[model samples]
Target: MNSSAFRPRLLAAAVSLCFAAPAIHAEEADVAQAGQALASISVTGARFDAEPSLAPVGAIIISADEIRRAGANDVNAAIRKVGGVYGRQSLDGSPDFGLDLRGFGTNSSQNLVIVLDGVRLSENELSNAVLSTIPIDTVERIEITRGGASVLYGGGATGGVINIVTRRPQANSRSASMFVEGGQFNAGEVRLSGAQAWDNFAADATLGTQRTDNYRDNNEFKQTHFSGGAQWFASQFDRVGFRYEGARQEMQFAGALKEAQFTAYPRQTLTPNDYGSLDSDRLTVFGQRRLYGHDIAADLSYRKKTVESTYFYDGVPSPATYDSKQWQFSPRVRKLGAIKGMVNELVAGVDLTKWERTTASGFSAADAEQKSKALYLRDELRFDPAHEGRISAGVRREIFDKDYADPLTFAAYDAKQALNAWELQASYMPVANVTVFGKLGQSFRVATSEEDSYTPLFNKPLAAQQSHDAELGLSYASATQKITARLFRHNLTNEIFFDPTANFGWGANTNLDPSRRQGFELDAEHRINAAWAVNAHYQHVQAKFRDGVNDGKEMVLVPKNTLSARVAWTGASQTADVGVQWTDKQRYGADFANDCAGQMPSYTTLDARYARTFGQWEWAVSGQNLADKNYFSQAFGCKAGIYPSNGRQLKLSARYSF
Candidate 1:
């Protein structure tokens, strides 16, 4: 059967079930109680998460309470324990790290979609959306979708999507918090945040600064961030919000070492004079209104970012600068409630974004511009009472245009591409405590400027990548325990990737023939009692080249196995947690021939945290790599060996809240 007919048939079956709902009677009170328990631990960043058993797309949520309990210093630290997430650490011990998802390798800047408060943060092409710009002290919660989301989020969501939600003021309330921390490696941090609200207005702000003299030679870093937001309730049915953020940071780079050097002196830096800096600013305004019995929302945002870097390769001076600016607008409408005696929820939206970047190297200058527009519609239906079962379908059409030009050289290049994406999802609860779900979707990802035109002499735009995704999952939840298991696969064509083996020392963009990634994930949380709990997550994935010269060969840098486990205990005044993480060895790059000579070794780590709360004051202490195990967190080609992860380090912090 054609896939196009699958969606219509699914919709018809759901409607028929709804019309025959009277024949089936469920325990209403029991259903409501089960729903309450599900809601307490459900993922809600997506439109389907509003109801029970409707989110079948492998979603994970990390709350602020969890973050604080983990003694997380940044976003990367808080998300490391999540399944299917691999955070590669640097030698400096900075939390501004890179991540790999769904066996997508180590370069996630072009494969992941990151957002903050409904505003696109990594929509530009200059650099990764530095998560450091958003202070963790101000975050309320984070939502992560582990699979492709091109139908919900516009583009470059081939790997997944991460949405960060910030704290908002409570009605008729005011609060403040302050934190100070100091640790090994001469690290120091300070943060302050406050929120206030009146009858119909609320405002909040956060300020933070941190500096560290890293463990490696010539690796020192400093950063400062400011974020604020205000919201006004014009009436009971309308509200508006404005948010602003700015950040500045500077750091010295310690280039990678050779194999022998890394083994003999792990903390040595190959390039001690290299340095980099960043400055960024963003502003967003959004509004929501209840009109015509529907919910309407709109947002507008502007962002400007600049980065400069100087590196010495083989004792040769090389300096470069990048400046990028972007504007985005999104408007959406949602309809909820009964329609034709069936519970129906519908959503429609449009998104528009424009971005421009300029790069200067020595005396040569180049400019690139990109624009995207999309229209999308989604519908959800619930057949049984209390939304025991749900079916959701969505479709999106997107248009993109990109251009690059050099004024002095009179060189120009342009490309235009259009893509269509759709997904079908269904979830059913055979029993009050168990849910079974399935999803099928098509996803698209366009190439970025860096991936297409930023090479030494490349000016042609790469072909857009496409993926066919399918997933099946089972979830079980009780009042005190939860368990989830998922099986997923992604078939990709013309997958764009960085070719480090091309053009000598400079990397080039290339499209691979075809590839496939299939994986299984298991996650569980159990509360032994009121004072003891345990959580564990595991993922096993196999990534291989399906066609071309590398057919049947495993993809480099994509690990086959990963695991995370944690145990915690809480008392009246104190809480303690112990966690362990492990990763399996995989092929390392440098040679595209899939040679076993470049394989990276596997390693595991142990960590612990303890916190005490008394009255309005709190104290916490944390230790990472508690076993002092030596491991390689990241490794490049054969020429650039591996970077050693941090050794045993301890830190203490103090916080006050009122």
Candidate 2:
């Protein structure tokens, strides 16, 4: 597979996904009008709006059109198209696809903050995001602010921020749409959505189901989701809103495997050791009012999630069964003031959460739970309409509840800890067409007792995790093209992991080392002509271990180079698109702290789609993996080989609206 023959085959396959548009040379008349204009105001803040370039930091604004073009129901696919974003699958399990920001993979939710509207979506325990359950249909747009935002967000702001804005109540519009398609390896999907508006109140709902043979033999999937919302204006001075969402998913789980089967038998048949059920529901209520020449706002949110899993071998359930639950609420208060020559908006908030987990094993019984709380604040000052800069800062203190241990399992242990984080962020627009931003931040995490002193076979306490992040970015745009690039670095303390060893053959969480990761990324959008459009992004990341950390190990399983591109053509009655993605070798082992493999091998994929509209009938056809390059994403495991990217799949779909 490493022969020179590989490059040509790869290039040939990738070229097939492209749908070259009929090119038309642009007239000089249009070139002059493409004035170096930059994009403006983004809804990633308190009022669901703000001028990001003017804010002085790095923010990735994803439009609704981008969402529709991705052609995938899962939100992960939406972000995956970006350079700095990646998703991971549970080893030997279904490629669950958890959101990763700036290379901070799974179970690192605290660093990668996720917010729905204004409510926190990351929970206690793992303090990670709930990416798999959020329905794409419920999202109007998403703004991803890269770099530390804890000065306003709290603990999870260590890595950065993701703000999801739900669809707003539409005006003078009524519509409903549905799509159904079937593809390679028994993959099929159906999606439906409807919306209506009357006066000042409106609402929308969406539902979808997708089943696939997955890239591996025993890997398969099924997901069901529902989302809806309502809003109202009580008076000229008062308003209120409510939203709800629920989802259920079941899938197989495979732990990472031995190298013998990992490389030598990358495609050999494999089996799953467990099955899991993930159920989640969320609700939100918010209110805003204008009084005494100032506007005030607040919100209350509630979330409940449970992960139930049963492990088995040869049809017999094992002791690895796990059950967990979470309860959380975050509230905020803000005041907007307009004075003589200045406008000031101040915001403050608090987050409350409690979580519990229990595992019953054929070998051992283990149980643990924690309750966490955080309070924070931020403010913005507006000086001039075209030349305004702002500063923000905040700190959060998290205290955990007393540990509760499973009485029957002598091998189980419990522990509690705390962390205090602080940060400062600023943004500025030196010119109307350009923006610059920077941030210096410090954030830390209390390690789980498991990371310190725990071997599945032996209970031991491990150390904690602490780190700091710094970022700087610049953005430029014109009518024809827009570009954004950012550079960032993170230094760590007590880098934790489950180390790999002989008796400790399995990775057990441990934190006795230090490390750092530095990276840069560029995202560009260009309109080549009336019929041609291009979306391109690239990233480079490097991780190095400090002396004696993880035994001075190089960060593995994290790709150092990633790239993505999509070119599209739209005409009078036809639309076409081509996309490609590539990733550098990904390091993986039986566990996080042990046996680091050199790489997963660099791989690429090409895909294309075409659609046409004639009268009341509409149809589309899509081709995936045109080169059939056998590849793998962090999404694959043993049974889910990171390399099973479907052997060239094509799906054709047609629909009619009466």
Candidate 3:
């Protein structure tokens, strides 16, 4: 069926399912209880402790077991299996994969927000988040909130929000684990982790090292990671903790290949001598306390990073170095009370951050700095005792002061921007195990330091990107099954992006014409029996220029259709899983005119894993791209910029507990 016809049918099916719940032969009391239980499951995506059902949009929560069953090597690998999300290999040949949501394509990194334990991981520059630095073993759960979330997360959250909660030491417990793995492409890894807890003190630490010679020449990578934390429980309702994390990474860049070169020799590298190295460290101190029916929390963190790279351009080696530092502090309070005989919740917070970067190149040096402050408030009201009917509203105001200086040219410029975001949401349960939710919000993004420095008008600051976001959805959850269907749209103005054809083909960062992204997403999971389970996700999105020269033209790299499915089995002490994903054809990157010679081809991939547990030891084998399918999900130019995807890969791993 055509897209126009399919959308309505799918929507109808979702609504019909909500009404048909009563017809199912199940205990109404049990279903109602299950529904309530699901509604009360706490989530941190809202920057406060709240139930997932109270959120304006659909959310996906991935547990640690799911990540393990996927046999993912990193956080990005695990996130790709989720619906309405796509992951692309990093251009720098690092493990930091690019995750795209809502078809933002080339600008996906700038549109999405990533939070780790209540700290923002998304950088203020053009680079993607360093997902590789986070060890998968440390992850307790991942919460994904779909659609704009600028009200609580500040800027650069126009696409969605992903919160990664790490594991913590448990009271009166002591455990240690060691893991070793070897895989194709000369990949190998070793990790050791341990935790100890006493009556009032807890401590945990992790150490890891990895090395890989990737599929392409000049793509060797080596990394080492270390993290440790200590906590002191002052009382039953108060605690303070401190954490330190550090990493060192070295990698070689293979560079992009042309269409012809990719077909002839996909593994060959034109820039064989290009190489880069990075050193990063972060320290965080956090505290939480409960007093007078209110919960208060705060976090302070400092991070330092240094990177150096050498690129051989036309056989002339050019070396550069970058140094950056960031400091952030956030404090918040949440209270639950009764208002007019109904339950009410209020959350208020403040965020303060300062960041600076210095870049030194062969011939010049530059410095950039940004200071930001924000205050936000969110409140929710529940109409019924079970929280079956609820309404929430939130607003945030943020101010940014940015400065740039070119030391060699004695040039300096400063700019300041103030942005605001607001959202209103409501959810109602019309029947047992069924809920309908809707939301309308405003989100905005300011120009990054790099984007401002390279504007078309010389040092002039670009306009803040803004979007009007809205979504509606229905969800049904029971003991054995869960399903959700959502329809969302974002109408944007002054979207910030690089336009290669702008400024007389000089190529510069600028605001684009009006654009819109509208889509439908469906996610479902079922437990067929004790030993069998299945899940599936489907998304259909239309991202296009709504006006100007590229009117009605599809955005580059934005696919219209994507689907994924997985089957899992467990019996005795053995577990097995298989999954498949398919992506539809899309316009090549930089093909804003939608007149490229050919679209990026559609492709499907298969992955599988099998594992067995033997007392305190576990062993597993996993494979990705089992079919050896060759496809590229990222390109910078029409038919020219190509990054070849990896071929078939296999790995074996063993873990021992003590």
Which candidate comes out best when scored by lDDT? 3
**Residue 66 in model 1: shift from native, Å?**
1.0
Question: Per-residue alpha-carbon lDDT of model 1 for 1-658, expressed as tens digits?
Answer: 2222122222112111111011222355544453344343234434322443444345777778777787887776777753336777643334666666677764565677887777777664523457876878777878777777888787778778887777655679998999999998888999998889998899999899998877677788898999998999865437899989898877776656656787788778766887777778889998888775466888899988777777665688777777788899988877655533445567888999998888777644779899999999888777675536778889999999998887755667898999998989887779888878888899988877656753435566778899999889998989999898989999999888766555564556678769998999888888999999888888899998899888998876777998888888888988888889999987765445676465777889998999999899999999889888877756656534466677788889999998
Q: Which residue pairs does candidate 1 place in steric collision?
A: none
RMSD of 1: 9.6
TM-score of 3: 0.92
Q: What is the lDDT of candidate 2?
A: 0.59
> TM-scores, in order shown?
0.90, 0.83, 0.92
Local distance difference test values of all predictions, in order: 0.73, 0.59, 0.80
Between candidates 1 and 2, the lDDT winner: 1
Better of 2 and 3 by TM-score: 3
Q: Which 10 consecutive residues of model 1 have the lowest summed lDDT?
A: 13-22
lDDT of 1 at 280: 83
Estimate the overall C-alpha local distance difference test score of candidate 1.
Answer: 0.73
| Reference-based lDDT, residue 571, model 2 | 88
Q: How many residue pairs collide in each prediction?
A: 0, 30, 0
lDDT score, candidate 3: 0.80
